[model samples]
Target: MKHPNDHYYLITFQYLGFRYHGWQRQPHVKTVQGMVEKTVNYVLKDKPFKVLGAGRTDAMVSVNNSAFQLILREEVSIDKFFKALNENLPPDIKALEISKLSDSDSFNIIQDVAEKEYLYYFTYGEKMHPFCAPFMTYVREELDIEKMSEAATHFEGKHDFQRFCESSDSQDDFVRSITTCVLAENTELKANFFPKKSYVLRVVGKGFLRYQIRYMM
Candidate 1:
């Protein structure tokens, strides 16, 4: 064991966001960060440490990758800690890696993140399976895939999307860079109606402001 003063870790992870509230701690809804703290503390048998995340993702928005930092008083083998963590962590949130980060009084992912991506899935015409219930959005009317695809192309590069973003949880700076946004037809896509078209919208960017995907689609 090492002195607690110098010990710290930068934790990287990914999760399925369907089961928990957005990242931040809330009164009622469970949160990803909350679960990580509780499970880690459980591993430590109640040793307390502060859990800090780079950015807080809203509910139903899955994280393909993310980072957080925690300071500790003791040194622990990374492999063993991760093994125990995987055992304690729920199916939704899984620790991908643990690395020591340079000591800094303050850490923020927003400033350091080079790029980020958000994928939104949807199908029109019919429902293929219940498994996609969480990610798939079924539309009552068929959206022109070509038109939508063309619209997506229009979003590439940086643009002021204030007019496009939905009217929920809006904030200043609607300008967002769209490195790539496209609509592609899903094969053999099924829906409530017979023989129809289906498509999924995949958008990648430096970052998304908020509800930007819904507005783009």
Candidate 2:
């Protein structure tokens, strides 16, 4: 239940997940949420607050855009808070925007999401430059791109994805719908150190179970 004094805000941020364990806060481990809350606490000067992420990402998985909900006991100067939040956050993480949420607003970050898109960048045959390790995956053997592309289409539409997900005993439903799944030549990201030829597996869905994308790839 929300306290009468509680002030709710929705914050959008992005992070390079290469260094953090994941999004959730865990004991004695660095995570995106851990760092974010730490910085928030610092900026708020020990003011009571709570944060909840829209969703969690796996270790070493980077995000171009993501968000979280922040609940505070006291209101803040939005411009000053936004500026300070970005300045204090680590270089790999950035605060994009912050907006106040009214009490009557019907927004639940976790449940209201329309869809999520994931891009798996990769290259094969030749080893990638060391600099590319953080952003791209490397496969030692040459891959049959055509075959992979064709196979990606099979995952489109609603289907039981139990084989592709890591589920727990408490969870029985494994069905998921894929609005888009395609493999294509990489044109989205370009770096001078990146390989001359590369590819990306783009997957879009309402939700994904843990390790589903990794297993699918």
Candidate 3:
């Protein structure tokens, strides 16, 4: 339950999750949420506040854009806070936008999310430069790109993805919808260190279970 005096703000940000242990905070491992909360606490000077992520990502999975909800006991200057947050946050994480939400607004980050897109960049047949290891995966054996592209089409549309996710006793619903799934040449992300021939597996959907994408790949 939220107090009547509480203020709500929507914060959009992006981060390189290569070093962090996914988005959620855990007991020992470093996480994006943990780092964000630490910076927020520093910025607010120990003021009472709550942070809720839109969703959780797996370890070493980077995000181009994502958001979270910040609930505070009192309102503060948005511009000042945003500036301070970016200044205090680590280089790998960036705060993009911040907007105050009115009391009449109804926004639940998790429930309200319409869709998400995930991209897996990979290359095969040759060893890649050490610098490329962080952003792309390399397989020693040559891969059949044509066959992989054909197989990707099968993942499209609605289906029971129970086998495509990590086993969980708490989850009862295994049905999920995939809006799009495609394997294509790596045109979206390019670098000099990247191999001449690389591919990307793109998946778009409303929701996904834990380790679902990894299982599918």
- Model 1, position 22, has a per-residue lDDT of 71
Query: In model 3, which regions exceed 4 Å deviation?
Result: none
Question: What TM-score, computed on C-alpha atoms, does each candidate reach?
Answer: 0.82, 0.97, 0.97
Candidate 3 lDDT score at position 212: 92
Which parts of model 1 have CA positions greater than 4 angstroms off? 1-6, 103-107, 166-170, 186-198
Which RMSD does model 1 reach against the true structure? 4.3
Candidate 3 RMSD computed on C-alpha atoms after optimal superposition onto the true structure:
1.0
lDDT of 3 at 28: 96
Error of 2 at 123 (Å): 0.3
Model 2 stretches astray by more than 4 angstroms? none
Alpha carbon lDDT at 169, candidate 2: 94
Candidate 1, 97-175: lDDT as tens digits: 8987665546455577777776677777664466666556777675678777887888899999887765456467788
Candidate with top lDDT is 2
What does each candidate score in C-alpha RMSD? 4.3, 1.0, 1.0
Across 129-159, the per-residue lDDT of candidate 2 in tens digits comes to 9999889999998799999999999999999
Give one digit per residue, the lDDT tens place, for model 3 in 72-128.
998999999999999999999999999998852578889999999999888998798
